[model samples]
Target: MSTKFPEIQGGGSLILAWQIKGKEVLVVAAGRIVNLLNADAKVTVVCPRNGLNEEVAYRVNNGQVKHVDRVFLPVDLEPEKKVAMVLTAIDDPDASTRIWKYCKQMKVPANIADVPSECDFYFGSVHRDGPLQIMVSTNGNGPRLAAAIRRQIGQMLPEGTGDSVKRVGQLRRKLRKVASGKTSRDISKRMAWMSEVCDKWSTDDFNDMDDEDMDKLVRYYESGEVPSFEEIRLGSRDHVVWEFDGTFGWM
Candidate 1:
């Protein structure tokens, strides 16, 4: 039977693939565990005295568990002693509930993979380009659909977009340094300067920038050379007003 669950709206860190690196994670299950070794999260897989641990021990190449135990001891629940994140992929619902409740009491974040009602967090579909990352979440309701949409969005992004992102970040740092050293206190002027720089930088211009081009552009911006107001007006497109009064209730 289908039931309607109340939707909770909140904002928190949308974890990226690289963010969990070097953190400790625990997976409790009886079968093959999906590999998380690439993320560099130290993973510990717990199972019964069966051969499940032995089978996994033979297959994995990197980030494999240093210790595979038959039971999770009570001492493991200590706030400072436990892993940062726990994932329960066990087939039993009752076991998942018990484990999740224990984790909650310990103030540890946990997820039951497909069992959203029992999870503190849901894994979202992620796409990455260097430092740039995009995450799509259906609030733990539709993971496969999220993955499909992520792939579509990934395909639409231009090649070398990550490089452009890096260049823009460098530009921002330069602008901030220049502002701190000499720019006026007027916040509006600073915003206008940013908009002008962004307005002149077209898609084609970004695509054409090689290492030499990027260096030159960086130097030009860092030199605190501002074009005349008339020149900026002539070169830039008119900014559009985004009216969200009707759409955003919070506004």
Candidate 2:
């Protein structure tokens, strides 16, 4: 059976949770060590003994930094016991390659930060608006581009979008109960009818709905009867505009 992936919300939690599945992670880096701080697991930082900076070591609680002359992971550490491997030593191609090879041999999932070619996963840029979350991914091509796109989309969303989602959820539950035990054809017909009703929805309609208003709308759907307000509202909105054709006004 194929495994179904959940709708992932992009954030540090998602990345950290996936990496810390086994409660331990090995972070191999030479510099730029701050990125690994978010890993939820007990992290062991492996770096060049001579190349290790005091500041970097201090960030991971000093003693957590393992001083190794060369970038070589412990072969005896069972892959099943270790949840993940993160390589931030992207500048040294040879060391990164060796570490990646070792990770592959051990059957551990590895992420070579900023090096998409060597990475198995790509972190996405996320935008949050109340209960709504929008994530953008480049499939390892460009992360900054994804972030830029996320910002643009975030700007366009209305502030009341989260409230709209809640209202829609209520409508969905009511429809499901109304359509329960119906034939496939009958359900499809009801869905089509609801689609027409949705076409009539305005931003104001969503914004103004109270429990009583929602209950009335639900009754209209259950009975297959059009609401009287809809006819009057739609009919009163027509307007005529006049334009001048250079010298005279044309109707």
Residue-level lDDT of model 1, residues 179-229, one tens digit each, is 554446445555666567667775445555455554444344544454433
Write the residue-wise lDDT of candidate 2 on 15-99 in tens digits: 4224442256566655433334443345566666555567765654555544444555565246565545555554777767777
Candidate 2 lDDT score relative to the true structure: 0.61
The candidate that wins on TM-score is 1
Ten-residue region with minimum lDDT total, candidate 1: 228-237
Off by over 4 Å in 1: 1-18, 30-38, 48-65, 166-208, 222-251
- Model 1, position 72, has a per-residue lDDT of 60
Model 1 alpha-carbon miss at residue 164, Å: 3.4
TM-score versus the correct structure, for each prediction: 0.62, 0.47
Model 1 scores what on Cα lDDT? 0.64
Model 2 poorest 10 in a row by lDDT? 13-22
